[model samples]
Each structure stands twice: as C-alpha cells, then as structure tokens.
Target: MDIWISKIGYYFLNVGIVLVYGLLLGAFIAKTMARVQGRIGIPIYQPFIDILKTFTKRQAISHGIMFNLGPAFRLAGGLGTLAFIPVIYGNEMFSNFSAAGDLLLVMYFIFFGQLGMALGSGESGHPYAAMGIGRGLAQMTAYEVPFTLAVVAIFIQYDTSSITEIVAAQQGSIWNWTLFTNPLAVIAAMIAFLGMAAYPPFDVAMAPNEIPIGPPTEFHSHFLSMMQMNRAIFAGAKLILFMNLFFGGATGLIELVFKTWAIYMVAILVGAAFPRFRTEQAVRFFLGVPMLIGIASVLYIQYWAQ
Candidate 1:
C-alpha cells in the first residue's frame, strides 16, 4: 500500500511539473521570442494569468464536441509522456512495473498530445487553421525520422532501455555525457527540438499572419487556456528531458530549475529573433541537416575514430 501511494504521488508530481513547465515556459518563450523581435517582454506568468482571465471571460465557441475532447486528451498525453519518461531523480512513477520501457515509450506517448490537437484543429472549420495544422503535421514528419535516429544512437551507445540506467551510466563522468561524446546527436536533437517546439523557423503551424490561431481559431475560454498551458508545460518538460539526457541531471530542484531556465531562454530567444520558415523550406532544412547530424551521431557513438 505504501509503495502504491508513493508511485501515485510521484505520478501527480510529474504531472504537475509538466503543467507548470508549460504554463511558465510557454509564456516565457512567447515573451522572449517577442523580445528578440525588439518588443518589450511580458511577465513570465502572463500566459497563466491570461488563461485564467480568458476562461472567466465570455464566448466559449465550440466548432463541435470533437474539438473539446482534443484539448482534454491532449493534456492527458503530455502528462502521460512525462510519466513514461522514467528519468525522474530516482525511479520512475511507473518503473516498478515496466522497467523495459524507456525513451521509446516517451517518444510514442508525445504523439498523443500532438496528434490529438492536430485533429481538433482540422475540425475547427477555419481554413487558415486547417492549412497551418496540415503544414505542422508535414513538418513533424520531416523531423521525426532524424530525431528517432538520434535517439537510436543513444540507445545503441548505452545499450540500455532504462532512462535511469542511462543517467546512472553517465554519473560522475564527463566522457559519458552524450552531448560531449555525441555532438552529432546534439545537433540533430536541437534541429528536431526546434521543429517540435515549433519556433520561428518551424512555426508554420501557427504562423501568426497566415494561420492566426491555427488549430485554435475557435478555441476560447477554458479550453484555449488549457491549450496554452499544455504548450508551456510540454516545452519546459522537453527542455528538462533533453538537458538531463545529454547534459546530466541537476543535483537538486534549484539547479534543475536554473539550468532549464537557461535552456528555455535560448529556445525562446532563437524563436523570437528568427523569422518563421516557409513550410516547404522548413521541411527540407530539417530533413536534410537533421538526417546528416543523426547519421553522424550514430557513427560517432559507434565508430568514433578514437
């Protein structure tokens, strides 16, 4: 009973982290991105506060009931991804039962959130939103292959499926850190991350002038607010996951928060300063550069000339 309770607690905690990261960092990303464009930044908590205000305000437009379920399950997907990562400080929230599952599970679970939102957007009856959503899906395809290869390289190098084991393997050693040993992986992952995070170069999905709100054209009130929160948490969580995997986990919450903040800053600044990519161009860039980088990571990991 005690063991079960602890696992439940950790699950909720992980879920909370996922949500907080999204709410805080999503706003931070938007603000920083704005700053890069020479605009004054908003408060870091702007998104959260905005969400609450929006929810309380009027006009909860529903494109259909289907749109409602998208955000609901989309959130579930994010929390589920975090829960499955198995890279928390010690054991995972679900490690007691499924140790074999690792990064693969994390990668797969994320699609749930992304795809759910995508479908919901298509149902929104907004042409711009549909166009953006379609482009976003295409963009996802462009990057996912290289990203998978980069992950495969890590799995091959470590020969393990457990994220905890992978982290432990790198413990107290600089050489073991994939970022140092596998710069190719770093490049590939960064490209994919930027794409996944949907920054300037890859934000065709929500191209402000083109798509407006993209899939969220009709979403307002609580639903839209939740969507904003989900985006924030997903980005922040990814920052932590990437850093912990490549750079090493922090000794505690403070270092963790601090490092993740720095990571988020880099991401947001880059997003803001850059211009949004043309859909075809963005896809080509990701497919080309990331594939090369991913292949290099595999070679370096497996047959580095050392």
Candidate 2:
C-alpha cells in the first residue's frame, strides 16, 4: 500500500512538471509566431491566467452529462498517456508506470481522449461541433496510417514494443539514436508528426479562423479549463515521446527540455512556412508521400537495417 501511495505521489509530481513545461512552451510558441507576423502577441503568463479565469467562472449552460464529461475525458487521455511513459528514464520519481508494451498503450490513450471529446461534442447538438468532430476524426485516421507504419518499423528494428526498451536500444552514442539508425522511419514519423501536432496545413479541424470552430465550441468555464490543461499536458507528452524515440532520450531535465523543444520547433517552423490545406488536401497529403515513406521504412528495417 505504501509503495502504491509513493508511486501515485511521484506520478502527480511528474504530471505537474510536464504541465508547467507544456504551458510555457506553448506560450513561447505563441509569442514567437506573433513576432514572426509583426505583432506583440500574448504575455507568457496568459495561459496560466486563462486557466485560472476559466476555472473560477461559473458554467452558465449545461449540455447534458456527456457534454459535462467531455473535458474530463480529454484530460484523462492526456493524463493516461503521460502516466504510462517514463519521464526521466531510470529515475524512479519521474518514471511513472511505464512497463512493457507501453508504446501501444500510449497510442491508445491518445485516441481515447479524442473519441471522448467527440462523444461529448456530439452530445452538444451544435452543428459546427459535429462538423469539427467529423473532420478531426477523419484527419486523425488519415495520419495514423503513416504513424503506425513508423511505429512498426521501430518495433522491428529494436525487436520490442516497449518504449523504455526502445530508448535503451538507442543509448550508447548519438548515432545509435533512431534518428540515425532508422532514418527512414524517423522521416516518416516526423512528417506524420506535422499532422499530429495539428499545425497549419493539417489544422483544418479546429483552425481558429475557420467556420467550423470544432469540438469544444460549446465548452466553457471549468470544462474549458480542463481542455486547456489537457492540451498542454498532451502536447508536452508528445514532445517527450518523440524525444525518446528519435533524439536519444535525455539523461537530465535540461537535456529533456532542450531536445523536446528542438523537436517541437520542427513542427512550428513547418507550420509557420505553410498555409492551411483543406481537409481533403491534408488527408491526401498524409496518405500519399508520408504513407509511402512509412511503408518504405518498414521494408528497410525488415530487409537491410537489421
């Protein structure tokens, strides 16, 4: 019982650290984008303030039980994803509950939150919300093709589905990292990541300027707060996942932050350079070159790289 209690405490601490890092990283991205476009942008503390304000506000409208549960479900998705992934690798306090096959479980948790959000949004009876859900799910499905292929390649290369084992395999030298050892898979995964990050061309599902405002259009107050919090946590968790998979997992907190930040910059720089694509265009793009690259990766790993 005491062991379980200690694990829970460590998990919470891990969550707290990731949450803060994600929020600040998001704010920095916002500010950087604003500067690129010649605007002053928001304060770095804006996200923190927004969370506080939203939580303190009363929910004036209720959209039924599922509607109420949507944000919670999304938050659960983020938390669940983080819970199963080792944070600092080897560090007991930050390792969370990571175990064999956690890579697959993490992927499931990622999908779980989106589906929960979809159910909640569907219950809201908002036409735009429905449209948003459809687009988001469709796009998610399209990208999963290449992403799954990339994972398959990694599994074959390392002979394991456990993320910790994958990270372990990559240790010893920089070239040992998947980024070098399995460049094809990394390329495919990184391309898919552009869609996964939901930036620019792939962001049609919930683009702020779009007519379809997407899932959380009807959410407010504490509901919105939870969603916002989850967004940060989820984003940060993804960055870490990529860092572990391809960048040589960090041995220290500073290294973790730097590597994850670098990985995120790949998406950010791409997003900044491109214009938004229509849903069809985005879907086709992912299914085209990225998909081909992913397949090639699996073939490469199975035939030659091994």
Candidate 3:
C-alpha cells in the first residue's frame, strides 16, 4: 500500500514539475522567435498569465460532454506519457511511475490522448475541426512509419524495449550515446521529431489563419487553459524522450534541463526557417526520404552492426 501511494504521489510530482518548467521553456521559445524576427517579445512569464486569465474568464460554452472532456483527455495524455518515462537516471525521487511500464507502453500512451481529442472534436460537429483532425491524423500516419522503424532498430540493436535498459546501455562514455553510435537511426528519429513538435511545415492541424485554430475551434476559457497547459507538458515530455533515446539520459536535473532545452531549440530553429507544408506535401516528404532512411537504418543495424 505504501509503495502504491508513493507511486501515485510521484506521478503528480512529475506532472507538476513538467507543467512549471515546460511553460517556462515554451515561453522562452516564443521570446526567441520574436527576437529573431526583430520584435520585443512577451515576458517569459506570459504563458502563466495567459493561462490564469483564461481560467478566470466568465463565459464558457460546451457543445456536449465530449467537448467538455476534450481538454481533460489531452491533459491526461500528457501526464500519462510523462509518468511512463524515467526522468533521471538512477534517481529514485524523479523516476516516477517508469517501473510500471516499458517503452512500448509509453508509445501507446503517447497516442491515447490524441485519439480521445479526435473523438471529442468529432463530437463537436464542427467541419473545420474534423478536417484538421483528419489532416493531423494522416500526417501522423506518415511520420509514424519512419519513427516506428527507428524505434524498432534501436530495440533490435539493444535487445530491449525497456527504456531504462536502453539508457543504461548508452552510459560510460559520450561515444556510447545513440546519436554517435547509431547516427542513421538518430537522424531519422530527429526528422520525425520535427513533425511531432508541430511547428511550421507540419502545423496545418492548428493553422490559425487557415482554419481559425482548428481542432479546438470551439474551445475557450478553462478548456483553452487546460489545452495550453497540456501543450507545455507534452512538448517537454517529447524533448525528454528524445534526450533519453539519443542524447543519453540525464544524470541530474541540470543536465536534464540543458539537454532537453538544446533539443527543443533545434525544433524551434527549423520551425522559424521553414514555411507550412500542405498536409499532402508533408505526408509525401516524410514517406519518401525519412521513411527510406528509417528502413536503411534498421537494415544497417541488423547486418553491418552485427
């Protein structure tokens, strides 16, 4: 009973940490982008203020139960994904619920909230929302091919689907990190990471000008606040996952922050330099070069690495 209680407490603690720092990191990204464009950016604390104001708003209309639950589902997904990954190597305090599941479970949970959000959007009876979800889902399918292949290559090379074990294998030297040892797989995965970050070139799902902020077009007030919080947490979670898999897991909080932030900046830099891709263009791009690289990575690992 005590063990179970500790696990639950740790889960919440991890979620809290992610929420706070994630928002700060997101605000930093926004500020950086603004500066690059030669403008004075909002304060680093702007996200917190926006979220608070959103929660305090008086008017909120719900299309139905799913519309009401959509944000909750998205938030849950972010937290669930965070809970499954060990945050700090060999640190009991920050390991969270990672012992309860492996990499495959974490992968499935990554999509759980997305499917829920899609269903809720569908129930909202908004054509734009549905169209955005469809495009997002199609793009997701395109990227997952390469992402999955890259993951499979890592699993085969390491002979474990347990994330903790994978991290352990990469220790002892910087050269042991997958980014150095399996460059092909890392390249494929990082390309997919760009899409997962959902910036320009892959952000048609939430194109503010084109679809008026699709998927959550009907969401406002507290619902919007929850979605904002989820975005922060989910973005941080993805950064951590990449850091663990390719950069070598962090040994301490400071290292964790540095590694994740550096990786996050890569996505931001790419997003700033590129323009949005139509859904079909994004799909074809991923399926072509990224997919081929992913397959070749697996083959190289299986044949040459052996």
Candidate 4:
C-alpha cells in the first residue's frame, strides 16, 4: 500500500513538472514567432491564466452527454499515455509504470484520445465539426503510415518492444542514439512529427482560418480548458517519447528539458518557414517522401543494420 502511494505521489509530481514545462514551451514558441513577425505575442503565463479563467467560468452550453465527455476522454488519453512511459530513464521515481510493449500501448492511447474527441464532436451536430473530423482523421491516417513504419524500423533495430530497454540501449554514448544509429527512421519519424505537432503546411485539420478551429469548435469553457491542459501534457509526453526513441534518453530533468526543447525547435522553425498545405496536399506529402523514407528505414534495418 505504501509503495503504491509513493508511486502515485511520484506520478503526480511527474505530471505537474511536465505540465508546466509544456505550457512554458508553447508560450516560448508563440513569443518567438511573434517577435520574429514584429508582434509582442502572448505572455509566457497566458496559458495558465486562460486555463484558470475557463475553469472558473460557467459552461452554460452543452451539445449532449458525449460532448460533455469529450474533453475528459482527451485528458484521460494524455494521462494514460504518460502513465506508461518512463520519463527519466534511470530514475524509478520518474519512470512511471513502463513495461514490455509500452511503446505499443502509448501509440494506442495517442489514437484513442483523438477518436474520443471525434465522437464527442460528432455528437455536437456541428457541420464544421464533422468536416474537421473527416479531414483530421484522414491526415492522421496518412501520417500514421510513416510514423508506424518508423516505429517498426526502430523495433526491428532495437529488437525489443520495451521503451525502457530502448532508452537503455542508447545510454552508452551520443553516437549510440538512434539519430545516428538509424538516421533513416529518424528522418521518417521527424517528418511525421511535423504533422503530429500540427504546425504550418500540415495543420489543415485545425486551420483557424479555414475550419474555425476544427473538432473542438463547439467546446468552450471547462471543456476547452481540459483539452488545452491535455494538449500541453500530450505534447510534452510525445517529446519525451521521441527523445527516448531517437535521441539518448535523459538521465536528469535538466537534460530532459534541454533535449526535448531542442527537438521542439525543429517543428517551430519549420512552421515559421513554411505555408499551410491544403488537406489533400498535406495527406499526399506524408504519403510520398516520408512514406518512402519509412519504408527504406525498415528495409535498411532488415538487410543492413548491425
């Protein structure tokens, strides 16, 4: 019982730390983009304020029961994803509940949240919601092709399904990291990450100008707040996951922040430089070069990896 309590305590602490870090990271990116474009941008603490205000306000509108449940389901998915993956590779306290096949579990949780959101939004009777869900799911499906292929390549190269073991394998040196060891998979995965990050050229699903903010168009007040919170948590969790898979996993919190921040910059910089793609264009883009790279990674692992 004591052990379970301690684990629960540690898990909450981990969540809190990542939550703050994720919010700040988003703010920093927003500020950076604003300055680059000659605007003052959002304050660093604005996300906290927005979340707090939303929760305190009354949500007078409700589409239905599933509408009420959508944000909760999304938040649960984020937490569920984080719960199973080791945060810091060597520290049991921060490791959460990682086990064999956790990588697969994390993937499922990632999809589950979006599916729940889709169902909820579908319940809302919003035409834009339905259109957004269709586009989002199609794009998601396209990106998942490359992302899953990259995962398969990693699994083939690492010869283990455990995320902890994958991190352990990368620990000896920087060169041992999959970024160096499996550049093909890294390239493929990073391309998918661009879409997963939901920035320019691939953000058609939630295009504010085009779709009025996608599936959550009807969600407001606490529902929006919960989704916002989950957004941060999910983003942070994905960064950590990618760090463990492609880069050397961090041994300490400082290292974790630095590595994840660096990984995030790839998306931010690319987003800054590119324009949005049409839904069809984005889908085709992922299915083209990124898909080919993913395939090559798998073939390389099978035929040449040592």
Compute the lDDT of residue 299 as modeled in candidate 2. 97
What is the Å distance of residue 133 in model 3 from its true position?
0.6
lDDT of 2 by residue, 1-306 (tens): 988899999999989999999999999999998998899999999999999999999655888999999889999999999998888877888888888999999999989999999999999999889998989998999998998999999989999888888888888999899999999899988988898898987898888788557888898889999999999999999889888888878878999999999999999889888999888888899899999999999999999866
- For candidate 2, the 10 contiguous residues with the lowest summed lDDT are 207-216
Q: Cα lDDT of all candidates, in order?
A: 0.73, 0.91, 0.88, 0.92
lDDT of 1 at 204: 79
Which model is ahead, 1 or 4, in terms of TM-score? 4
Which of candidates 1 and 4 is the stronger one according to lDDT? 4
Angstrom error of the Cα, residue 40, model 1: value is 6.1
TM-scores, all models, native as reference: 0.88, 0.97, 0.97, 0.97
For candidate 1, what is the lDDT? 0.73
What number of clashing residue pairs does each candidate have, in the order they appear?
4, 0, 0, 0
lDDT of candidate 1 over 78-119, digit per residue (tens): 666666554345545523222455677778867778789877
In candidate 3, what are the lDDT values of residues 221-289, reduced to their tens digit? 999999999998898888888888889999999999999999988887898789999999999999999
RMSD (CA, Å), each prediction = 2.8, 1.1, 1.3, 1.1
